[model samples]
Target chain A: MGFLEALNYPIYVAIFICVYSFLAIGLNVQWGYAGLFNAGVAGFFAVGAYTSAILTSPDVPGRLGGFGLPFIAGVAGAMLLSALVALPIGKICLRFRGDYLAIVTIGVAEAIRIFARSEEWITGSSRGIQNLPRPFGDLPYVYSQLAYLALVAAILLVVYLLVERQSASPWGRMMRAIRDNEVAAMAMGKDVPFRRLQAFVFGAALMGLGGALYAHLGRSITPEAIDPMIASFLIWIMVILGGSGNNRGVLAGVTIVWIIWTASEFVTDQLPMEYALQAKYGRIFLIGLMLQLVLRFRPNGIFPEFRPTQKDSRKPDKSDKA
Target chain B: MLDFINFYVVPGIVTGSIYAFAAIGITLVFSIMRHAHLAHGDMATMGAYIALAASTMLGLPVYFALLLAIPLTAALAVGTDKLFYEHLRKKPKILTTMSTLGTALMLRSIVQVVWGVGTTSYAKGITRPNDWFGLKIKTNELITLLALAVVVLGLAAFLNRTRWGKAMRAMSDNRDLALLCGIDNARVITLTWLIVGGLCAISGFFLGINTEIKSMMGWNIILPAFAGAILGGIGRIEGALVGGLMIGLVEELSVLFIPTEYKAVSAFAILLLVLLVRPRGLFNGKII
Candidate 1:
């Protein structure tokens, strides 16, 4: 494979990095900025993916379909719907701290996956809805995937800038205040739980946006794409490995990890193991190893987020010592 | 009609006992460690698999296999703690929780890679179902009930009697206070994992024997197992024992009204509703 052939895979990986980076940022918002240990990111991601697919796909008749809504509308729809679902989940989970919240969110995401698997009418169950219309589906030699990649990148860039701006805003500062010292924040007359809820909802909406972008890029919608493990574990690793509180750190983390993931997947055949088994697990092992190493050495992640001189790190205050 | 009650309800109790057995390990570790061992189900599976590898494969007797698996799983739990979870200490609870998430994924992959990602059954095939006092129950199911009763009783005695068990209780009550009281908190924590590992193995054996054995078998039941743990009051062993039984009975008896597939959701439904309505859990935990 020459440059062009090799380039396609990496280019595709770039797109994945772009999408997952936003997903990580979304998680970084919920977890890093707010003390919400949301393990159900995959649920919001699926919500975004399914919403986009359902609205754009030609298959379903009765519900929201056949409009061929513009990509922007579909993306916005996913964001709105995700925020809607997040409102209650955020409120509910905001009350619990640490392990209790983790268990609940993981269960919630799994339940969502189960619901997705069972609800055939809306999501088409296991068969999945494919050939979801792209904005320029019929244009010849369009490098359609490349175009989708550009579109996703643009959305991600906007989200990144917006999150950066908001993280510096009064509300964002209040979010960090609650995360750092809830008692003090409450003493300062900040509605601590309410602030956390806002962060949760905002973070979840970002996840929804990433999910919608990913679904369109993949050119198909399937329940399997949104495994809770994939949504939660990978996003957690990204935020942790990339400086969780740092926006730039998050970008570096997402890019580096996704590149390794996609690249390892490509090169697994050369690995010295049972070809059949190793190929399947190659991706998981790589990510798992990196997660362990990062947690061990740089629990704060690779690039420590630049703490604004006035603000403290919004990361979870030291809790349990291993 | 009377026969149906004996067959279903009685059998339901037996099945519930097994779930309760499994839930005990999860609850113990969850309460103590403050983060769940996502691989609790897999620990059970690993125990069952260890029993198979040691006893049946090596030509050891059934009891001998279990004897080996008990200690081995206990050791494995310690190793897992040191290797994976140890790195996550003092990090945010959420971050440590994610580490367990990573650990679960890693352990699952290791199980799949080692065992070929397929279901493996016990070599000693279960022989027969029996009619005891007009109630039809499989021998394995009977064993499940007996094991649950014995384990629960044994755990109660251990917690109430032994110095180490009491130390564990102290730690569970409050880690900082436990340390302040001159309790070797680390040693107590390790012992807790050991006991949990052994008991969890038995639960694993029963689970695989009752159904098909697969690597994902434990992972699949994780949600329900968590359900049992939470329902029982997160840290209380007695609570876990009761909660597991309740979840299991609800799941089994629920099949009559629901499609069997939906039976799995019963525990989660209980989990969600419980968390929503009663966050402190059925036992009231620290509050009461």
Candidate 2:
């Protein structure tokens, strides 16, 4: 194959990496910083993807579309709608324990999947929304792939910088404080529930944006594309494996896990049909096994959370104590 | 009304019994271990598939196959705890919950690989429902209800009468206090898993008998099962039973008011409503 052809594959993979990074970063804000367990990442992701698809796709008879909005509006609408959905969910579930939140989120995601599959007028019902506007789609395949990669990468960088800034601020510190010791944080007058809701909604919006980016890249948004195994659990593994509290670590994790995942698919494809199908499941088994091992041995992940040391002046003096 | 009772309520009670079995397992684990056992559904799936193998491959009868599966699934559940959850005992409880999620994925993948993701049953031909006083009830449905009654009564007897069961209850009520009382925490935990796993297997088997056994069957029911568990009260087994039945009835009867396609939403809606209005559950279960 030609050099550009080889480059094309890498570019496509890179675009996906960027997309997954968005989800990982979003999850990190919830689980890593705020200690919120959200098992329904795919639900919010589907909401985002479908919202954008409906917003941007050309008119389709018997379905919700014909807006023909620009890609930016679609992306914005995706984030807005995802956040809106998260608001009530977070409000209700965030007050309870983390496990409750996790189960509720799973239910919500499943409900959303059902809605997308059955509500034909809204989501085109399993067939999904088609003909999404991909930026620079008319360009040649290789160039277009590269251009999309650049676009996603640029967006990822901007998101990374903004998130880093936010996490480094007092808000991040308060979130960590709440996560580590909820009672203590509550005592310190940190409106605990409200703050948690903020994190949950904010994280969901980012996930929605990631979905929009993915939908546009594929030029379609299908119900099949939003499976919980890939869209939710995979992103979870990325965040946890990368180091949940660390954005850079999560990005690195997205790169590593996505590569392993797709690379294994390539190897499995070369196998005979039945074995190949088994191999696909085997890969999931391995990933799940990998998670157990990771949680067991290295719970903090490859890059552990960095705790800033307090100044010595804040330490109690031995002489004064004596 | 008679048609609704036959078609909707009968099936509802049957499925509710299945969910009750699953919910009981979930409530047991939650009360004893203090974390949501996310793999409960997949463990049930594995149990159903194991019974499928026993009946199909080993030529055992369906009930005998289920008998074989119960202990095996219980052992698997206990082993899972030993391998994956043991080390995380001192860590945050949420970590163990996440580990179970991973376990869920692992168990499901294993099922998919072995079972080929296709629907299967013990027997190919469909059995006609026998009419009982104007109510149409399948033989399997009657079997499910009887089994549920037997399991519930047996469990109640065990919990109320046995020393080990009391110890398990003590641990659920107060872990540290139970430890102080010289109760063997490890043994109690093992016992809890044994019961939970066996119950999960029974539920999975009933679901298989009632409906087609597909790879995703357990997964699809897990949410409603959780709703049932929470609605009845997390630690209370009877609560799970009532909650499971209620959820099943609501889901089936929802077809009256809404499109059949949206039946699953009823469980989720009930879950949200219960969580919002009564986090402590119907029977005053622990908030956690």
Candidate 3:
């Protein structure tokens, strides 16, 4: 490929990285801070994608759509729909151990997938919904992509600031406390399950936003557009490898993992015809191996969550000293 | 009623036997090792594929190939435990569960790569069902039911009557106490994997015998098998057997109400219902 063509590939990947960063950040809130396990990240994502598609896509003859809402309205609808789905599941599963949540989430995701494939009126069956309007779609290809990238980055910045601020606030501290020791938190009269449910819903909403961004970029939505297991697994690896509790680390992790993931896809596509299929599987095997290595060698991840020093917290405030 | 008995109930029982067989293994592993073996279904898939290889390449009869696959799959299961899970035993059991999800993907991918993605069957010609006084049944179905009975009885016998089985039971009941009493935790774990692996092979083999062997078969079974385990009670072998059969029956009978394509949803629905109503399961399984 020529330099400009190669540049095009990286720009596309960069857009995905931004999209996945939103997912990883969402997962960080759930798994990292609240110690909730959501194995169905793709479910919330699909909900967001389809919700936006239904809300914003122009009128179709047979299927549900043609709301013709603006892009921002679609994004809001995506987040709301995702959180709505998360609400009941989080309320029920958060009462038990995280493992229950994991299983339920997996089930929920699978159900979403089956529904997407079967509900023709919703997802348009196999053909999928198309002609999703992009922000700068009328511009030349390269400029449109760059514009999308800028738009994604702007959204990511706002999400990052909000999440960081939340994690620093009393709410984050309460979540961490609940996760670290639920019994102790309960003893202190904290509503453990409710707090956990909040984190779970909020995180799922962020994942929905990521999905909306993805749908707008691709200009379409399909049941098979994303491999549920692989997408969910990749997000898990990003959160775990990036330092679950750190947003910066999550963003970094998403960039690194997405690059490696897409780079491997490029390499696998280059193989001879017969071996190419096997190469796809070989890549999955390597990703699994990567998880093992990370868990064993560096369970804490690259940038472990920065637990504020005990001594610093103990110091009296300047106003109190005065 | 007779038609229902012949068509749905018998098939459900056969299918349930497989699920129960797999769930027994899952329950055992959950009780002892303390995590859902998400790869259990995949391991069963591996077993089925190995049998296919043995039959296709070695020119063995399908039954003989299944017999051959049993030991091979068991050994592989043990090896997986040693290679992947042995180290993570110290960490939270939940982390081990996560690794198994990855392992499940890797195992399924390996199967797809080695066998290719297309569906395949062991023997080309279809076998007619043998009518036994009006209840039509296939020989393989009969064999599956028999094997499930034998395996469950043997496991119960082993746990109650044998030394090592007692050690395993002790470990499951109370690991620290078992250790304090001088039980070999490592040995029990290895033995646990052996039985679990062997059972996984049987379930997978039976599933393949009844259905076509496809790369995605294992993934499809994971939810139902887990549902069976949890429904029967996570740590109760007999409970899992019952639960597995219930799920199998519900799945088959569900077609009467819903579209066939949504069959897989039955298992998840059963699982969610059980989790909601009686998380400890019918037999009062360990709550962990």
Which tens-of-lDDT digit does each residue in B55-91 have in candidate 3?
9999999989988998888898889888888899987
Alpha carbon lDDT at B71, candidate 2 = 98
Q: For all the predictions, what are the DockQ values?
A: 0.50, 0.79, 0.58
Task: Arrange candidates, best DockQ first.
Answer: 2, 3, 1
Off by over 4 Å in 1: A1-6, A60-67, A270-274, A308-322, B2-11, B124-127
User: Residue B2's C-alpha lDDT in candidate 1?
Assistant: 60
Poorest stretch of ten by lDDT in candidate 1 chain B: B279-288
Reference contacts reproduced by model 2: 0.79
**Poorest lDDT segment (10 consecutive residues) of candidate 3 chain B:** B97-106
Q: Write the per-residue lDDT of candidate 3 for residues A1-322, one digit (tens) a residue.
A: 3665667877988999999998899999999999888999999999999899888999888899999999999999999999999999987788778777888898899999898898888889788889888899998787788889999999999999999999999999999999888899999999888889999999999999999999999999999875675568889888888888989988888888888888898998999999998898788777777777777777767888888774486466755888
Poorest 10 consecutive residues by lDDT, candidate 2 chain A: A310-319
List the candidate 3 regions with Cα displacement exceeding 4 Å.
A1-6, A309-322
* Highest TM-score model number: 2
Deviation of model 3 at B265, angstroms: 0.4
TM of each candidate vs. truth: 0.92, 0.97, 0.95
Higher-DockQ candidate of 1 and 3: 3
